[model samples]
Target: MDDIRNIYCVGRNYRLHAQELGNEVPKSPMIFSKPTHALVETTGQEIVLPGNRGEVHYEAEFVIHISKPYKPGMKVEDVVDQFALGIDFTLRDVQSELKKKGHPWLLAKGFPNSAIITKFRAFPGVEACKEVDFSLIRNGQEVQRGNIQDMLFDLETIILFCSQHFGIGAGDIIYTGTPAGVGPVTDGDRLQLKWGEEILGECFIRLG
Candidate 1:
């Protein structure tokens, strides 16, 4: 995980997720970013966050790892080397305020441990990915599940957009967006991330 460079994220890439958050569905990819220091691996250990924040919501996503420098015409399968399930932990209240003020989301999205990911596995190609379902399990109950086929902006579109506008390259990872069931996570919550039926990673939450 330490080798990761840029952390790019797409917001409201799922139509239902936009509606659930009272946000309009974007016509194009909604790009955002978190600093690299926000990353923490899901090693079944306790990860801590600010307890005083109003609410910390978990947005589970499909994380894509770029293997080589991106080129405009390259396919996702050609550039991507691995994939994993990850959580984009948000300070929801802070984000709401930022949105209202028309400000950047850095304060809400870039806190320590805000970006959590499971171990990466070899990329299985785009079609193979669309056939699998990834999910977030909280306290042993599934809270969010998603498949790549449902994304408003698919992998190719996202990669191209990021590469064209922001410049993607090796060591950058994209958090491809989450599904509709996002909600607040409290301290002591055990969160598990799964790809298909295999549990990729799990961790306990601790608020300080």
Candidate 2:
């Protein structure tokens, strides 16, 4: 079995999502982890759940794919050369329950297809900056909107922090975290994750 590397998530990345989660203006970015298998690719694929959580919530997060390994004392600029982005889906109900018990949100965050992502193509001339407009349309109605600029932690910071614990190497993908307005996804439902004019990708829900 492929040993899952790491599931890094950012909290209160988006101001609006922070408000929706009832969080105060954060002093620093809150981070967490899900299982590796939780990842889902949005390129013409479907999301299938393991039924561990009651409601599989969707969080449209900006993902990062590391292009190379980082050396110790590496500055953000050093690894800034390699940054890719994607989405991080969540399980709200299970996450909430775990919070009540002061538990780890492993099960809630790490389920099959819990993390939805698109291919990582180099984003150039953006100053390690991102301008994104993301929404998940269910039944043809826009349900979520997240802009990358709204993220509390930018690519540099996220990559810097990530390297502290893990050696970011080639093919290492990071789901930056989500924006607010998260909701449930059911079987037979189709989801669209779009970034501005380009459609990042889409996925359908299939119940087992």
Where's the lowest-lDDT run of ten residues in candidate 2?
A: 76-85
Model 2 spans with C-alpha error above 4 angstroms: 1-5, 50-52, 71-86
Which candidate leads in lDDT? 1
In candidate 2 the C-alpha lDDT for residue 51 amounts to: 48
lDDT of 1 by residue, 91-178 (tens): 9999999999999999999999999999999999999998899999999999999999999999999999999998988999999999
CA RMSD, predictions in order: 0.6, 3.1
Q: In model 1, which residue pairs have backbone atoms overlapping below 3 Å?
A: none
For candidate 2, the per-residue lDDT at 59 reads 73
Tens-place lDDT digits, model 2, residues 1-208: 1323565777777777778777676776677776667765566666676445577667776665555677766654454333333556667777788888989877677777667666655654234345556666776778877666777887667777777765566556666667777777778888776666567677787765
